[model samples]
Target: MEALNLTSSGPTTFILNGIPGLEAAHIWISIPFSVFYIISLLGNFTVLFVVAKEQTLHKPMYLLLCMLALTDIGTSTCIMPKALCMLWFGSKYITVDGCLTQMFFIYMIAIMHSAVLVTMGFDRYVAICDPLRYATILTNARIAKLGLVGLIRAVLLVLPLPLLLRRLPFCANRVIPQTYCEHMALVKMSCGDTIMNRMYGLVLTFVIMGSDLTLIGLFYGLIIRAVLRISSKKAHQKALNTCSAHICVMVITCATSLFPALTNRFGQGIAAHVHTLLANLYLLVPPMLNPIIYGVKTKELRDKVGKYTCRM
Candidate 1:
């Protein structure tokens, strides 16, 4: 309910340091980043297209996969282009408004990604534990509402961040030591009392993401217990296989995302370039890997992709 609408003694333009000590390798670095970006685009778009064309894939699980593809697209697109621009062309300056807008979308997608994973976890839990009610419980309307709630949660929580920054007086040290505008990075730039900013950001991130991951783990724990109760070994194997891909994705996304945040906040002995590099990789890994994991693991989607590829 509080608002910080006044702009303070902060610089209107902020400089994004692409990499602290690797300016020369910036061009070389662009190569791999570009590859990851292209792969993410192709892979995610393929999933969206395949899901759209195949009517039989219109169930809750596949609908959730489409949501994952969209968020994956968002996650990479939000970070990669700005980073690539800084790397390739040395265009590292961002306006305060520009910086704030970028921060909103980046963190929004990050939150939504966690929510989608949580929803997917719920979907699996229902499918594994309450198979008879899976369809009835997760109708199209329910899925849409869940996605909408995630969007609303992300927006309401992240909206205050930029507004909070507006109230702070940033010193003349306007160089942000990364390729993109991150919340803590921007907060650290301020010379004013930013206890509120730090507290809000920490709570927003740790609470939302931490709870999502915990729910995912809990979902799997229940799923594993249910599978064990099955008398047939073959049935247990089938159930485990169904969850393997989603769990693998959660592990990859969870580690890559959390580690960089940890490195950003508390990695005192860590080098500046290490933080920058990890942040860049953090943005790239999940998008590039998600569709591939699903494509390999989900048989129906895999078959559709294979048939589409063969026709191509």
Candidate 2:
């Protein structure tokens, strides 16, 4: 039976890898990564600013967009700056407490991102499936409640991760083979039996992301059915267009997150640096693309951004 390798003193520090096999290219790699980081920061911030400043965007959908933008900013901030510093300055040492804190916020924002996506899906469902009651159902007070519930849910789910990780003993190598401190990466470094940690992570991913994806799919199904019932072609087109931005975000997020994770868990032949790159992309791409997607696909948002920019 596997047992906890308890010790009086736990690991004090961990060294993070910039990229598994790309140390020589860290400077070159930092260029694109830096661009993505800067764009993600500016994009997400712009989305939040536009949504907040524009009174016309005070609806539930835009409010959820604000939540997503905030989550993206939080998620990107947790990963990018540290990774950039590691690449740029060769500062790779992170204390155990700092590692755990980074893990906490990364997982927290990720869960919050999923929750926000689900809420956006729900907003779409209400908007399309029952257009008449959309206003009443997704009121500002109710959206606020939903946002609070999402925050609580994300907090509750991710709360155990760092705590559980703190209990494990690290007798093996303390170097994490990634740019950032991932929960699983930390767990993999522990000499102690980490079945519980691994199982909890797997279960959490399945329960939270699985359920959110299912709910989004179901909502879209209902939405499609509702759209099909519409008689006019223009009305049908309009209904679908409303959902295009959310669908794009949903696809990008799920693809960026799920594929790399599945490959990491199951792909035995995949390169370590490939996993690292994927993990970085999973965190980076959505935040980078989300604002552009919304700006292009969402006319109201585009118009608001245009007006906001023109006034400047």
Candidate 3:
């Protein structure tokens, strides 16, 4: 990775390849990206509306679902439109400031997603293990506080990245080989020494994502134990059923994120186009699938969705 001399006096604009190593497929590629974006927006918005309108969904569990839906929307929205434009219109140039902003929101939403999932696990644990105290422990105010904490945590952690990047002299290639302005992608283009930048980003990701995963696992472990202790099969099944939708979402979210991160880092034999597709899917799949999963798996949500769709 040889560094090039700075070509201009001002900040540079990087050319984003809509689908690197697959330029000829950009037009056709935009079709699916557009479809996914539309579906994600509609699906997440519907979840928000449904959760808001249905009084039965005002409880902590459903409220957490609502938060997860919102996080999905934010995550997908940050990248999809630019990616669509690049695929369809050849609008691949992104300014440094704009790119940093996109990168910030992208990581911020991802962190919020982990936070929401962890909180959802807590909601489930309380509902199952301490049913008598669930309501008292997770009130509306506490949920709001959780959201605030997630936001603050992400902001505090990710805020330094763009600032640190901005301070670096990017006297190198101004071309990024992906559809979006990811932190690592942009860092790879810099001419200046980025040991600190790289190390901090990796450390932050491990700390936040790692802690969230551990907490989620612990909560689910407790939930599982509590469910198994139930004397009747029916009660055990009922408790597990209550947790199924959330478990599905957590699996999907973690799988999508982990696959790309691991593949990019270690799977050198994988095709670049495949990596790009996975990167795109990381943003698209969750938003599009989450509402569908909840709508199909949860009877109450399914009934409400069916009624709402029929009414509309």
TM-score per model over all chains: 0.96, 0.96, 0.95
User: By how many angstroms RMSD does model 2 differ from the true structure?
Assistant: 2.1
Looking at model 3, residue 97 earns an lDDT score of 74
- The digit string of per-residue lDDT tens for model 1 on 109-216 reads 989989999999999899989999888999978998999999999899889998898878777778898889989898887777999999998898799987887899
Please give the distance, in angstroms, between residue 80's alpha carbon in candidate 3 and its true position after superposition.
Answer: 1.0
Ranking by lDDT: 1, 2, 3
lDDT of 2 by residue, 1-312 (tens): 233333445556789988999999999999988899899989889998888887888988888888888998898899888898899999999987888899999998999899899989999999988889988899988988989998999999999998898788776477899998998888887777799999999999889888999999999999999999999999999999999999999999999999987887787699999999999999989999999999999999999899878988
Candidate 3 residue lDDT tens string, 1-312: 555433357455888986778999899988888888899889889989998999988877788888888998999899988988888889999987788899999998899889999998998899899989987999988998998999899898889998888767675568888999887777777878899898888888779878999999999999988887889999988999889988999899888998988787678899988988999899999889998888888898889889999997
Deviation in angstroms for 10 in model 1?
Answer: 5.0
Worst 10 residues of 2 by lDDT: 1-10
Off by over 4 Å in 1: 1-10
The deviation in Å at residue 62 for candidate 3 is 1.8
lDDT leader: 1
Error of 3 at 73 (Å): 0.7
- Assess each prediction's global lDDT (C-alpha) against the native: 0.89, 0.89, 0.86
TM-score of 1: 0.96
